[model samples]
Target chain A: MEHLLPLAAALPLVAAALLPAVAWRRPDAAWGWAVAVGAGLLGIVGLLLRRLLQDGPFSYAVGGWAPPWGIELRFDALSAFSLGIALVGVAVLVFSGRYAQAAVPPQRRAWYYSLLLVNLGGLVGFACAADLFNLFVCMELVSVSSYALVAAGGGRIAALAAFKYLVAGAVSSLLVLFAVGILHALTGSLNMADVALRLADVEARGPVLLALGALTAGFMVKAALFPLHLWLPDAHASAPSPVSAVLSALVVKLGVLGLARVLPLFAGLDWLVLAPLHEGLAWLGAIAIVAGALAALLQEDLKLMLAYSTVSNIGYIVLGLGLATPLAMTGGLVHVFYHALIKATLFLAAGAIIHQAGFRTLRDLRGVGRAMPWTGVALSLGVLAIVGLPPTAGFLGKWYLLLGALEAGRPGFAVALLAGALLIFVYYLRILNAFYFRAPLREQILAVREAPLSMLLPVMALALLCLLGGLFGSGPVALAALAAARLAGGG
Target chain B: MRRLLTALALAIVGAVMLAGLAGLPRPGDPAAPVHTHVAAHIVAHGVEDTGSRNLVTAVLLAYRAYDTFGEVVVIFAALAAVMVVLAPAAAPPPGKTAPPPSPAPAVAPSPVVGFVIRLLAPFIAAFAALVLWHGEALPGGGFQAGVILGALLVLLSVVMGRGLEQPLVPAAAARWLQAAGPLAFAAAMLIGLAGAGAVLGLPAEPAWGRHAVLLLLELGIGLGGAAIILGLYLQMRGH
Candidate 1:
């Protein structure tokens, strides 16, 4: 199972490379192949996760070369996020079967699934990477695949959005690569653990600060934290729904996770005061929460609203990290997992409605709930979860965040968090009202049927997970706390 | 005012970056960590450990093969991206055609130019092969050879006026060729596991084993890179 660490990331990529060839004669076969690969990935992740639970954590040095000389892949508590990635990956792939048949052209379908697999492979690799250069490489794989996935559905607006995303992604990737290079120069090792050890002896505070600053900024942009989030809404909203789910649920978290990974690198440096950075992050996160929800409230398009909600949710995670309390960081990490499930549920359910009814806006999709009850119930569960309603996955993270804010004696931030939640609730209320209460503004919505089992199954499973994530929240919360302890250097 | 603000932001960022870079060790300083740490190790043991005369190839394919594998996938993804964005809508019925978005060169290639390219083609191919074959012992390697071959193909296509409508390689074979980089890496990974007991580990016993693995990677990367470049060219040409 420990040996499976590298295979977990490699299998998806190898399968992806073979997909177009295998499906060349019959493009329809691409869907089955992608789902099977995705399921295989899930199975591998399950084995790794079980191993992680039993043994604590494990590392694999590729090519039998030891760390600092060879690339190291670590499956630690922090990397437990691979479970979420694989889960969402399989769901999204299963969901894409029906969605792509409608949304993507037959000729482009194989490439579409191929890119998604590459994106998933990259995300898993990024989570497990312990080497600085390896992290950057996996990040590039994810970024390139994501930019293309945005334009995969193919339209002028999507092309334009993809270009915007490309510019932002390219700049961020360069920043990360630049920092990696600097770290290598400073420490003479590309391994993160080795660099952290060596960084303490380095005399150049300027370069150290610069590297830290560059990494934070780059990852923040990738995570789409506010102010740096200009490219996210257009890109996420315009992408094909499955791509949107992957980007919103898993890809953006890369930045937050990247921050978590690199923060500990500079933790041992005495001259570097992370307090100022934390303070700034907390303030910005507070602003993003209010601003993102307000922005979501104004959007008529369902996908657009979901995209903005992602920005707001990212704020909650960042705020939790910024608070720098064990509880807070734990909350943030837990949200990272839960948000992936909840957002994926929302996007896929919303995707089903839009695909079936041909209506994307709230007003256009009015009374869609009655027409598609299961998907509507799933979307509602997702909506309730996202709003931080009680006993839902969303609530636990926010509750922890609120307690963390108070625990840190920052009532002002606590107020901001509560206020943001209220704003989210009000906006989500509008969705519920529109979805369940209003008369059908578009008659075709009445004729729309329940989403097919392929799409419905993934959405329902995710929605159920969103609920289970809350009810059985202790497991993930414990896992997150373990990760948080390590990030805080307590372990 | 907006332009001035933009310039101000750019200048500030540039100044900060420059300041940070200023703190780095002086270039080519032998005592710097970059030289003293991993580089020193590679310099000392690279040849014996990896059995490549050229240290760079040793580093790329042996010590840090995973990163190289990642890079190969990145290139593959680039081609996938291009095709996803630019591929024509579901295959047109046989014998039906949409006019090319951009017209072919208005004038034909000069006879002399074509003749010169035709004369140079075989020599270029031979040179590419040499570069690839000798890469383990020299500075030239897979990526460089790939660029050379890809450029030659692009040049021939230009002189021949072969639009994507009639690709130099058939579409079916082209897909596999474009995927050759990752496919080769996958094969190497399994071979490494069987012979070397690790994924991507090169076997040591048969003096020729490591060389065979290296050559396989070189061919895959070289061919795959060239195929992808041509595919990109043909796609962007908008037939």
Candidate 2:
């Protein structure tokens, strides 16, 4: 079981490598293989999570070399995020069956599934990576695959958007690699724990601060936080829908998780003050909240609206992290988990509707809810969840964050949170209004049918999880609080 | 003025980074933490522990083998990425299993140039084999040998012209070979588990088990890298 740690990530990757060859004779076999691999991953992660719950936290030294010498994969509170990765990975892969069949070119389907698995494997590997260099490697795996996935559906806009994303992603990746090199040179260790321990003894603050700055900037761009989010909307909007779900739900969250992982490295230094950094993060996060929501409100394209909303929701998570209290961090972490579920549901449902009706804009999609009632209900549920209505997944994160703000004696931040939520509510209401209430701007919308079972099942399943995640929210909140405690405790 | 501001910003960033780097311990100073800590241990035990005479291979294949596995996947992913974006456009029409027709070269290579390439190819192949075979004792390793082999294939493709679009390797075989890096790692992992009790741990009883695993990895990386490089070249050359 302990050896199963590496297998959690490796299984998907090896399966992915085999996918194209396996599907070569029968192209459609790719979907089944991918979904099986995804389910296998989910099972592996489940067992690991169970072990994590039984034991406190565990570490696996790769190739039997003890850490500070060889790479380590730690299944700590932070790594529990692999569960979310696996869960959403399975959902997204299942959703991709019909979605890819329709949207992706027939010749590209196997490669598309292959890229998706690599992306999931990278995300899982990243969450469990206890070595800085391993994190960088896993990140590259995710980043490269993501860029290609955007263009996998191949149109001029997708290609252009992918190129733009590639540039931004490359810059961020370079920054991260530079910082990793600097840290390695500074401390002579690539292991995160070893680096942190050695960093405490180092006298020079200059290099440490530089590495921290680089790491923060790099991860912020990866997270698509605020001003750095310029590449996200176009890339997300232009991508095939299932790819959009994976990107918006899981990929961007790695950036925030990266921040959480690295912030502890600097926590022990006496000369370094993280307060100014936190203050800046808080301010940027607040502004992003308002700005992203406002941008979402302005978008007429349905997927583009969801993409901008992703930017705004990321603001909520970042703001929680910025507040820098255990409660605030818990809020942030919980949101990270719940938001993955909510956003995946939203994107997949939107994909189904668009795939069915062949119209993408709000006006064009008007009354689509009435036509495709089941998918519309799921989308509406997603809308409610995203808007933070009570007893829904989205509400808990924002609620905890608002309380965290007041707990930290920051009423201003609390007000900003409310204002952002209100803005989000307004945009989401527009989606509901267009989707359900308004007369069809296009007459053909009335004739559109519900999405096929393959597409519909995954969307409905995710939407149910979105509701259950809130109803059974205490379990995740408790786990998040535990993670927050560990984070708040200085390394 | 905007350009000036851009330059100014870059200069500022460069200066700060330089200042930070200057604070680093001087390179090759034995007193530096890099030299004294993990590096010291690797230098001491790497050979004995891993059974590779080349300490570089020892570290790469033994102590930090998992990272090597990741790197292999990264290379594989690179190929996967290229294929996903470009393969569809370059693919043969549906229901056709035959290779896509390559547009004829505008000017055929000079027979003398072609002859020279063909003449040099065998030696290049031998050199690649030597690099891979001697990786345990020499500076050259799988990636280096891979680049050599990949370059050889590309050179041959250029000279061979029309018939070479399918290249030396068949399409079906090329797919498997392109995955050789990761597939080899997976094989090594299972072998290690059976023989050594750890996921990538080389066995102690056989004494040759470690060597076999290392050689297998080298071949995988070398062959896999060559295939992927060729695939990228062919795909990007377009239909």
> DockQ of candidates 1 onward, in order?
0.75, 0.69
Q: What lDDT does each candidate get?
A: 0.92, 0.90
lDDT tens digits, residue span A1-491, model 2: 89888888888888888788889888989999999999999999999999998987899987788888888999988888898898889989998998887788777889899989999999999999999999999999899999999999889999999999999999999999999998988888999999999999998778898899999999999999999999999999999999999999999998999999999899989889898998889888999999999999999999999999999989999999899888888999999999999999999999999999999999999999999999998998898899898899888889899999999999999999999999999999999988878999999998999999989998998899887778899978988888888778865
Which pairs clash inside model 2?
Answer: none
TM-score for each predicted model, relative to the true structure: 0.98, 0.98
Off by over 4 Å in 2: B90-100, B162-165
Interface RMSD of each: 1.1, 1.5
In candidate 1 chain A, what residue range of length 10 has the lowest lDDT sum?
A: A482-491
lDDT of 1 by residue, A1-491 (tens): 46688888999998888899899988889999999999999999999999888888899989888888888999998899999999999999999999998899877899999999999999999999999999999999999999999999989999999999999999999999999999999989999999999999999888898999999999999999999999999999999999999999999999999999998999988888888999999988999999999999999999999999999999999999999899998998999999999999999999999999998999999999999999999999999999898899998899999989999999999998999899999999999999899999988988999999999999999999998888999978988999988988822
Top model by lDDT, which number?
1
